[model samples]
Target: MKKLSFTTPTAQKIYNDYFNRVSRCTRTLPEDDQREIMMEVNSHIYEATLAATPQTEVDILVDALESFGAPEVVLQALVADKKVKQATRTFNPRHVIQALYLNISNGVGFVLFGVIYLLIVAFGTLIVFKLIYPQHTGLFIREGHSFAFGFISELPGGLTELLGNWFIPVVAVLMVVFYFLNTLLFRLLKRK
Candidate 1:
């Protein structure tokens, strides 16, 4: 896209600095993605400047950038979205973690997803506990109603440990289910 020329040096500097900040925000993304984002921002600025009422170049540029908002704040969602797309495509844990961190503040859905992921990790760690403390690590049921999934410090008379040898498999299967459920939820969120 052709760069916009301003009547004053200050306006030009303002425009350049804005683009520089945008470039910084998008640097981690792929080149094509970066260019696409830059182009989109440039187009918005151009259109804003054109549609703006007659005014000083500095005033017009300032208004446009202000309305567009600080690049760091406004472009956060876009960067997070692109990161998520890349993460999903690559299926890399590092990328996925980055994507999640970027999107963590989006809403309750991301928060819930994060908590669910931590639970899955905790469940995975339970297998180690099962090995180290076999007696206290199984699914325990008290009064055949109250149940717990992890290590129990004390076994009361009413509490019975069930799924003795099957605890590891049960936790593993549960983790898989939770993982898929989170994936489904993440896809739904990405669509939004």
Candidate 2:
């Protein structure tokens, strides 16, 4: 097996890419610790390159480095090392927003799960309430304000009561509409 070598350009590119990705992913490591981790990563890359076959040096180096662990893993380990001083890190807006995007992409499933959970809770609560104090439920509804504003002067009292009964369904329709709008906004922001 022939010894491999990385050109200056290739080494620099690999180092910079690794550093940027690592910095973006982690918030714990001090500057010296981060530098040490990067140095170790570059050493790995260099060693892997020297061991690579004739097919491709870059590919082999990348595969070897990845096999060891991702840059993020290295950063985590370095941060955990006792020699490194621990500091409270604030969340960067870019990181927070990226996390939000990831969550929102998977949010439809989460929302559905939440809806089912909420339905179960509501049903249980209603059953318990009825069993404990059946008369109170009707009294509570009767006393509650059905509408945000009693503006429909022409409507009969029976019609108002029916509208009040449909309040939950109306809110459900609004929530569905808002979900679509939020999805659209998320897509647009991601593109930017």
Best by lDDT: 1
Off by over 4 Å in 1: 1-20, 39-68, 104-108, 153-158
lDDT of 2 by residue, 126-192 (tens): 4444445443322222235553322232343433243334444544555556545544543443344
lDDT of 1 by residue, 1-192 (tens): 677888799999999999999999998777899999999999999999999999999999999999999999999989999999987777576777888899988999888888888888899888998999998898889886998879877767887888989889999999999999988888888888
TM-score of 1: 0.67
Q: How accurate is candidate 1 locally (lDDT)?
A: 0.89
Q: lDDT of each prediction vs. the true structure? A: 0.89, 0.47
- Please list the residue runs of candidate 2 whose C-alpha ends up more than 4 Å from where it truly belongs after superposition: 1-15, 25-27, 82-84, 87-192
Q: Which candidate gets the maximum TM-score versus the true structure?
A: 1
Question: In candidate 2, where is summed lDDT lowest over 10 consecutive residues?
Answer: 82-91
